[model samples]
Target chain A: MDKEFFRETLSYKIITFLKDQIAEKVDLTVYIFKILVKVIKDILNLRVGMKHILNQAARFGVDSLPLALIIVGVSGMIIALQVTSEMVKQGAVDYIGTLISLVIVREIAPIMGSFAIISMVGSSMAAEIATMKVTEQVDAISVSGVDPVTYLITPRVVAGFFIMPSVIVVATFVGLFGGYFPVHNIADIGLSSYLDSVWLGLYEKDIWVELLKAAVFGTLISLVCASIGYKARGGAIDVGVATTNAVVYSFIVIVITDFLISYAFFY
Target chain B: MIKFEHVSKKYDDKVVLNDLSFTVDAGETLAIVGFSGTGKSTALKIISGLVEPDLGSVHLDSRNMSMVFQYSALFDSLNIYENVAFAFHERDDLKNKYTESQIMQIVSEKLRLVGLQNIEDLMPSELSGGMQKRVSFARAIVTNPKIILYDEPTAGLDPVSSTVIEDYIIRLKEELKAASIVVTHQMSTIKRTADRVIMLYEGKIVWQGTPAELLEAKDPYAHQFVYAKREGPMKTTAEAR
Candidate 1:
């Protein structure tokens, strides 16, 4: 009887813990989904709040272009140099463009582009929203009969959605150009030959996949950042925690998304 | 009129407000006074719909309301003009009645009412604590909301600034004819602004009457609170610890 009672009590505790954990995650997911729906609705009704979305898009997409270009450019050059050196040793240098193009487009560009967005834009969104929450600005807005989801989250998500792809496109082109430089200068391959192999290796489907991945990753980053920040409580320390959480969650989501997209498209 | 009936709120295991009820008539200023953590600010938040009571309901005769937060809660990214304008721009129907220049005119006018003008181009961070409070006041009154909630308006202000805010509350009551609920620690503000006062103790109204009655009240808790006495029914944090 004693053993049965102890086992029953232990099982109850374990079940309660698991239930609470699932409930918390479900609650968070539901909140995020609600914000996502509101954002999509605002996009469909673009004429209603066009000004905010345009301003956010300009801020999120245009401002980050320079950084995106530089990071992708450096990343592509490094990969190209390494790939060319390895291929040269194997006397398979002709296939260097195939390796670089596939790796950059299918993997590197979207992931790096998102990393830039997560580090820069995602952290900013989290800090701004968390500060708003801490200072009662979020409550103040809500009291005005304006839903924060519509007024705050929508414009940001829309802006991020448009900007992520633009950054990725910039990253892709910068990366391709970056690969061309190392191959032409160091690998003793002509620009035209590298260009020809890149052109031959590239597929219409791969380009679509890169664009799709960028858009998805952008949405995930913005959604996670805004949600985490909006839910942040307490003081300045909470805002810091929210910002860190936003970046960490965004990276996790982006990597998981990248894997899913690559497997779905490539496999 | 704004009314909270049988309201209760708790944060985890600690109860903030328990079975609280109150009402503020239209065009009347009601002061909520208490020791810190007695849920005075929470009561105002309940009335403003910033927080929903765990039990009971808050009924507002009009949906239009504005709250002046304790920390001012100004949008840090926006300049003074934009912060005040946010109140107007948030309502599409309101925005339809005014052109960009007209909206700017309204924002300028509201700023002037709070004794702030030409500082519209400046950010909230550029302003002093008093100026931020005044800016938030401008934002609150810009729309001329039917109900106004001031949470610790004078809590952190200097004497001169507190006087300014107190005087503005009186002026706004006259001009807008709006119902106001003010939560404060300053005795002078209660005498100056409130038509009636309610003293909260442990989320319950222990004594309630006009400012005059608050002074003469026999309730030990009320006496200790109003006179800022060290000895009475209320225990200091150190003593309690």
Candidate 2:
């Protein structure tokens, strides 16, 4: 009777829920770290295939380029549209390019580009691996004496690390152009003034920081998604669940890491 | 040779296999027959090292073992040639030994051994289910494995297709002279491919004998299984659940 009463209490339920959530998070973190360590070891040993790495790089970087550019570009345009007229009214027309370029380079482009990638490439990677897990392709690979981590996850993580910075570089340029269109048409700013403002406001450190953030975000997204997918069991429904978790977890990790990196560099 | 000694496995609170012991000599095929969820596939996985038993040991004379999964489990991203040649390309001991041209020749020969010819460029998705199973067979023997495990090799196939797969199972056994385990409930599969049979229930083997003894024996479980009777000592997965 005492046990039943305790179980019926709201506090008990809440505690149980918290415990379950914490356990799951801990498990996920451990799995991700294990995969990261294996991937690093495989990379150091040159166990990862170059062909597989290039193939994944093409998929993650080249294939995701157009969508990433469009997302970042639209975000840049929206920011410029909302701020340009107001800044001009305050006699701050010269600062429009500076503010817009600063935001685009330091924050907007990397985040939005990663968001696009998490949706497209990361989710697909999760689903593909989850399907393999369910169908026993992963087991077959293991039985064949090949490490699934080296065969499947290493190439993807390596590709993400190397290719994402390139994607961000292109997205950053496109975002600048996107902001320029809105600023020119709405605030009647000259190209030379806007260019001068952008030139003055942006520093070399910002570009390097952006690239660093992109590389980190890319690696985290791939690793987290693949780890989640590798943990999938059961059947088709579990595959779907794994894919959704991959996307959600990648988004959360990227956001938190972005804040931490930004705080460390600029604070 | 393959040996399983005092193996036990459980998932969460449910026991799947309990104190199971078995052996298959080199060049012999053993069939594990049971209803779904009785640990037939689990036994195969335990032998292949895909699943670790909770308590016991699996002894294999050689480390070279291959598992042909129920659904073929071919890598969708690769063509038929790549799929068959996967071990040569991926396995550490074999990857550096074979040149690309040598791999191509071995893959072609293996595919032809399974009665498939010149379809190496097609993807797994393009093949029929039976053809995919054959390709998986080709892949399984590509490494010249000493122990081969098949999880429902004839499952989800038409009668003709099932016969074809059974034929290949016997043929591969003859060719490789390897110890083999086939997990299945199909009577035809047991009779045609399995040299000896074991019937599992409630995490234990309830009966074992040659295929002839399996058919003629009056053991309640084997009787129920061979006749497909609704009333018997054995329970269906739904009833067990």
Candidate 3:
């Protein structure tokens, strides 16, 4: 293998893979329809005929409870301190609830909640499929009569996709209380005005928009991570490589897509 | 009964099986004896449906089949019971045919049949090579498949393990009344297990007969192969065939 030959071969493989994928591209219109159907089916599977969304609520319960205590707890204290110090001079610290709502609901909740899950779930999925690939378990699945797509990918993607919005909702609630500690008595922000600021941010459009963002972020994380896991190669070392790649890629996609979607929201 | 009809397989233009055809009848063990790279495993893969034939069909006459691969094909994650119950996991038909408890019970019975009782929860990594081979056998028989394909069952085992494997193969045929196709390079294994021997050379069946016929063979390839001689057909084929 001369350097030039190696370079050509590697490029050839990459090009070939891309070409194959392009040729085999599933219908985008059909894929969206399929995903909607899957989401509906998932909802039905969780519990039938419940007015409240079990998928979303269960996701919130599973994802946000502990996250609320730890990551958001610290962030909440820092946010309260930062906002109170800045706004007290202007004597507008009463509006800390409003500002925090804007940042948490619009950005931080969506990013932080989903990003953490991606690190936890994405790597595990990758390690799982990678081991199956290394040991021929996936091949066994195929030979035996089950499609790997339905058995392995569907539940995780569905669970992960819906879970983020729920988690973000929990994060937003946690952050609101987090802002309360330093401000209620220390910063001289009145409780009545703070409640008003929090309640006013609860517009129907804002809630829906936040939800759309959470869903997009969740889907992207699960899709990228599951895709990486399903196609994982090499051995034990490869699992680690895949895990790192999945986390990095999921975070990057979340940030970029979030920015793009946010820009579209206003533009 | 399994039959390979004019089967040819190739990878990157190097022909592995070239117009190879053979038949396996009911209740008989056909041992395919050949050196490595002579396409023995490739042939086994074709029959097992793990690898598709490029130029032919592996006609099963609709007979159900299973395989114990040369290497331990047991799932590392699955315990001994689940590993043996693998055939059930493959098909929706198997799902309908056997309940989970029934599948597990059958797996335990098959494990014991292979002399691996009380170890159904052991992982594949815990087992030695020969034990793994026995578990693979358990997997093949768990379904009561009519045709079982063993790809080099005794390749890396010590003499004791090898003999155990051979006896288990015999017991499986006698007790389960299933046809078996054993592919190996071990002449002793062929003598011990094969009722009929097929010698493959350059991706084709050059010789096939009973072990008695193999002993009486005048064909240089058969003679050289049976005696493990480095002086004849296999040697010449490796050099220039």
Candidate 4:
């Protein structure tokens, strides 16, 4: 081998191979980062888009409200018991009320509420957009004297962000009560501390945190779900794949972001 | 009326359609024909604004248009009635738009027109392939569209379903007096529904004429495509036709 090619003492072949690996790794990082940025940008756009979907979906309010309530109630009951059990074992049973309050109001309720919304509204958004995408319904909307963003995205993102907070607020109360009932019915924890430890010491920041989390979580959920549907290609199978990816990505982002946000808030 | 002026479309540097120009007169049917990848659907999509043309402008005077997808674009979460009603429910700044009752009536009428009135309560899942197509068609027409674009309306359907969809297209032309644009691989659909036919090949409109003219065109690509032959200038997977 020429000195120019071999003088580095690393074989040219191995060096070239390493270079290729780095290039691939860099490309993958960019791709993943692009997706993450898209998710973030769409979430930011949610302030407007989600409102429209919520307004439209709300017209059939008789259907959407009860659906929201049932999901909130069920998730609340299950989460309250499980988390309190863990806290109890740590000799932190008294903190159970406070911890439950934080989890439900600040994190669990918002995330799960967004989950329920995604299951109902997010999936629908994907199916709608995917169907529109393949069938050209979205195209129809675009050509018909209207911008698809205003017609589609604006409404959906709006609905997601707006409705999420409302649903989360309700879900938070339900989740705390979910914990309260178990603490009363099963743990036999008295009502005095439950009320005092949970509701009595409520800080303005806690409320702010809850609302902020709800709003952000809600907006993110819609943005991620609708954008996934918006970018989806191929046929029904592609839609299915997009839906799955949207859910998995949104949940993963939510968990990571929630932890990070919580750390920033408390630490 | 809609016009495509020297339109070209590319995806990731792969030119799917190139340098095509055509016009659809107000309230007229224009059928596009081509072998797959000759960019027939892409042409339709270009005009419909589903896919932007990389190098042309599609101009239309009418602001209200609808597309009937080959697979039907009904929302799965919606029942048949809501799916049909979505056109009316869509928010727009237009004045004197279809009222809710008016929209419902139109939905019922379109459902009746498509022979799917009995299944208004069904979700998209509950409908058969043919029924789904019918529901999709109703949703399109329920908007009272000035232009209706159909992408492979008869694709993957039984002859009976094909004829049903074709008949509805013809009826929409005669009764609703709507302009129709159809892209299809099914020659029978073209023959039955298209008032005028255009063929795309290698991104160009290789042929354009009435149905009779299309049937008699001596162009090798048109002949290969309309006749569903695997021989001639049209490229197949394993060979050129």
Candidate 5:
């Protein structure tokens, strides 16, 4: 009788916890969906100012450049080194460039580039909007009859959506170059042979696929961060908390989205 | 002119405002006084549409209304000049409204009116608390709004700073000629700025009178609140209901 009671109590707790989590997730999804709708409406109405868009683009593209390059470059070199070392043991060293090119183009470059953007640009966006909320700057804009979403959010989303794919293209190239260094020296592949392998491994479909992933990842990062930040209340500490949540949630969503997109396209 | 009719608001069943009704005509200042958590700030928020009343309605014929927050809610990213000129810059729909030079002139004049000078480049973080509040004042009046709401504008200020703010309230009352509502706990502010006073107790207006009449009101709640007495009809629990 005691064991049965305990089991029933534990099951009840678990069910209640699950229900709460689902409710929280649904709330977050609805919030992000509302922001997405506002962004779309602002775009259609031409509510976004070009100057703000350019400023945000510069922030996402220019400020994010060094981090994207460093991460993708290091990841590319590490992948090439690890893969080439194994290929040497198997006497399949000639295929080092082909394997590195395929992995870098299809996965590593886009993911690492997105991580850089989510950490650098998305976190800053969240912190900024969160600070605005706590300071009542968001309220000030609203009371002025200005749509805070249009004035504050739409530009960043549009900039991220448009610029991230270009950043990813650059990251992919830098990553390939990084891979080239290890393969050419350690695996003794000539530059021309490496180029030929890369060419053979990359399909035109992969380019479009990677671009689409970047776009989706970029939109998710900005929308999640901005929405969370804008909705935040209380004081300065809340701003910091919102920013941390933005980073964590953005990274999780980006990875999940990448998986979904890959499955849809590749499956 | 603005009016709140039969407005009721609650935060999770604890009533903040209950069946409250009030109005402020143009060119008048209405002061709302209450103890902390008595919905003074919430009432202002409801009028500004920052918050919604759970029941009843708010009628505002004027579209141009501004609220000066207790903490002065200035945009931290923008410096003092830009913060004050924000609304002016946003009026792009008005053809031949004002040139950049004219806007700058007006911003300078407003800043000067708030007793700030030559610090337009300074960010909100760099300013003292009092200065930030004054900057918020400049921003609020720069648009020449028809209805202005001051939420604890004198909160966290020194005596002198409070006087300066009161002076602005009086001066701008005549200068801008806008309807103003001040939510504050300070009786001095009520005496100096208010033409009509409403005392909130237990989410309802327990007393309504002019500032002079406030001191002589016979209600236990009003007596206890105005004199800051430790014990009175202002119960600490819901048992009063």
Candidate 6:
């Protein structure tokens, strides 16, 4: 009876669940770190194939650009619509562009751009790799005496690391442009006034920080998504699970990393 | 030759292969037969280095080997030509060794060897299952490997397709004179291609003999498997429960 009670108790169940979750998280972190090390080694050794990198670059950056612009543009307009009226009421019209530019550059563009890519490019990468793993395509690559990391992963990671900033740079400009409509219409601010205020608020440090954040987010998304996909087993169901986990984990990591980076830079 | 000495593997608490040992000599084909979940494919994976055994070692006379996967496993992104020529173009050691013209010639020759011709530009998704399997076969031999492994080479195919694949297996064995391990359940594949056969159950070889012996032998495991009988020493999951 005592054994049954201990096993069936809510507290026991909670503890067991927590333990399993922590163990899974730890295992995943170790796997991702190992993959990252391998990817870096392959990149440094120049073992990563150039053609593959260029192909992945087109998929990750070029193909994802239009959607990223739309998402960032919408987000920028939303932020402007919400804040411009209040700032104008407070007679802080001059600071309107500053607020919008800072928020777009530091926060909205990177985070929203990452979300867009995670939805489009990152999920597809995960699903593709997960399918490969399940179908023994990965095994075939391994049997051919080719390093799967160099062949499958390094290219994606390298593309993500290098192409993400370009995506964010494009997204940043689109977002800033998106803010223009609301500020001009709602607050009656002229284009030149808005442009001047945007220029005044911008600093070289902010641009560098934005680029750095975009690069980190890009690497993190690709690495985390691919690592999860590579570890997937089973069939179609497992592939679906892997894709979901990739997107969810990417979102969580991006938010957490964004917070950490913001605190480091601004605080 | 390929040798497995006291190999054992497990996933979590379930023992898939326990103290398994076997050997396949050069120019010979060894068929690994088993019911589902009996570690037939796991044994092949261990040999191909796709999976490591928990306890034991696999010895190979040559590290140059290729595996033809169950589903063909051709890279979907690459065309039939690229799929067959993958090892030559992608492997670091071989990529620079062949010129484009040489690679093209080799790819065409391999595709022809598999009875496939002039379909190089088609994607894997466009190929039939048997054609895909043959292309994978061509890819496997692209490196001129001294060891070749096939995991269910004739699975999910029509009878005619299976026979074609079986014939190619024999032809490849004759041409490469390589050590080959075939994991399969089909009796035709066994009778047609295997020089020796080993039956696995519960992670151990329950029977070992030639194809003729496998058919006539009074071994219960072999008999039940060969006849596909419901009443046998091997129990299904429901029967076990």
In order, the candidates keep a fraction of the true contacts of: 0.78, 0.88, 0.34, 0.47, 0.56, 0.84
Candidate 3 regions off by >4 Å? A1-92, A162-199, A209-223, A232-266, B86-90, B96-101, B121-129, B199-207, B210-241
| Model 2: colliding residue pairs | none
- Candidate 6 residue-wise lDDT at A162: 93
Tens digits of per-residue lDDT for model 1, A1-267: 999999999999999999996796678778788877777776687623778878888778866677778888899999998888888889987889888998889888999888887888889989999999998999988877677877888778777777788889889989988998888777799988888888888999989998899888877888889998998999999999989978887887789888988888788
What's candidate 4's DockQ score? 0.35
| Model 6 ranges off by over 4 Å | A1-11
Which DockQ-derived CAPRI band holds candidate 3? acceptable
Per-candidate DockQ values are 0.70, 0.84, 0.31, 0.35, 0.64, 0.85
Candidate with more favorable, higher TM-score: 4 or 6: 6
How are the candidates ranked when ordered by lDDT, highest leading? Answer: 6, 2, 5, 1, 3, 4
* Window of ten residues with lowest summed lDDT in model 1 chain B: B232-241
Candidate 6 docking category?
A: high
> Candidate 2 or 4, higher TM-score?
2
| CAPRI quality band, candidate 2 | high
TM-score of 1: 0.93
Clashing pairs in 1: none
TM-score of each: 0.93, 0.96, 0.73, 0.73, 0.94, 0.97
lDDT per residue as tens, model 5, B1-241: 9898999999997999999999998889999997777888889889988898999999997878888998899988889898888887654452248888998899999999999999989999999999999999998988788999999989999999999999999998898888899999888898999999998876799899898888888888778878988688676444345
For candidate 1, what is the lDDT?
0.87
Worst 10 residues of 2 chain B by lDDT: B41-50
Q: After TM-score superposition, what is the CA distance of residue A64 in candidate 2 from its true location, in Å?
A: 1.1
Model 4 over residues A120-167: C-alpha lDDT tens digits?
A: 666766666766676555665564445555565556555555666777
- CA lDDT scores, all candidates in order: 0.87, 0.93, 0.73, 0.72, 0.88, 0.93
lDDT of 6 at B2: 98
Clashes of each: 0, 0, 1, 17, 0, 0
Q: Where does candidate 6 chain A have its weakest 10-residue lDDT segment? A: A3-12
lDDT of 1 at B219: 86
> Could you tell me how far off, in angstroms, the CA of residue A93 lies in candidate 3 after the best superposition?
2.8
